[model samples]
Target: MQLDPALPALNQTVLISGPGPFVLLGVPGLVALHAWLSVPVFLLYMAALAGNALLLGRAAADKALRAPMYQLLGLLVATDLVLATSTVPKALAVLWSLSGEISFEACLAQLFVAHVAFIAESSALLAMAVDHYVAILPASALQGTPDRYSVVGIVAVAAVTHGACVMATPVALLQRLPYCGQQALPHTYCEHMGVARLACGDMRPNIWYGLATTLLSPVLT
Candidate 1:
């Protein structure tokens, strides 16, 4: 493809593209069925949200469920709520209205929240496992069991670590690359590497970082 001679910057070999909106193509090969698909997807989203909300409410109301294990379950429920809320509204909009344009900033925010919530949920599950292990052990080994403060601290650390991974190198690399005007995303959500792949420049760093985080988050928890 020849560059437009009228624009000198366009002729440059390295052109840094500015941040722009992206078009999310929800569920490729299913465009023809969006009308039928959206109804069920929306219903599932609502049901999941309601179920999680009820869990949180019960945890908050009952004094007997205030144990650390129950607290971790509550955290998991909350994380699920956040994860769904982060992506479903935008996805449903794309499905129902056929409008999938998301601003670069909004897309990044969505990616961050979705990833952090997933990581947090995993961490909660790990914490629950540890709690169960401590409970099952004879009283002698239980002395070393972590307290509620420690559990809360661990969850906080997981959130911070995952948040840092998403906000640090991948996003910076995304902003530095040039895009060849390819903004269509293949999936319903704006995953970091998914958007990064649309860039015209080298995306290896973003890809590697994304893979590293995907493997490390669960292990670290």
Candidate 2:
């Protein structure tokens, strides 16, 4: 079969190649009603943002909230903020503009922020568990538990651990794989598995690493 002269060559690199813009279709089997669905989604985002902001402000302003447990709550609030912001605004844009296209760099940034925030939240919950233990137990065994240093250390470790496992390695692997297939992401956010699935090459490493880091966070914490 002869190809049309006006059409670009099959092997031609037309710039919209690997790691190209991706479409974030919000929710499964709900794309046809994106406009109507966006209303509630936007409202929920506002409520969550307001609630977390208030919690963070109260924790920062009140002297009583200077305790380690409250500080941990503040950490959780920050993580929630990141998690919500990483997707909600872009999702709103996708709904309103009717265009879900996102640049490769922006998608990568969103993917990193969302995963880190989620993992951090899980780690924060684990830290809160330890704090609860210390609070309930007699003070004689551990007189100065749930101190500022310990909270800071836990947050730092979670950030580093998830950053290395999720953000650094898997993303690097995904980047190396050629994304010559479909670019439309099924969910409302740029996630590791969603993006990795679009790659044309071996995706086992990405999948395994994503599962490992996701499962290991709670286990280790």
lDDT for model 2 comes to: 0.78
Clashing residue pairs in candidate 1 are none
Write model 1 residue lDDT over 134-211, tens digit each, in one string: 768887866866766577667757765765665667667877877766678988889878888888779888888878
Model 2 spans > 4 angstroms off: 1-16, 143-150, 153-157, 160-164
lDDT of 1 at 130: 73
Among all candidates shown, the one with the greatest TM-score: 1
- Listed per model in order, the count of residue pairs whose N, CA or C atoms clash below 3 Å is 0, 0
Q: Candidate 1 — which residues are off by over 4 angstroms? A: 1-16, 144-146, 156-160, 219-221
Superposed Cα deviation of residue 189, candidate 2 (Å): 1.4
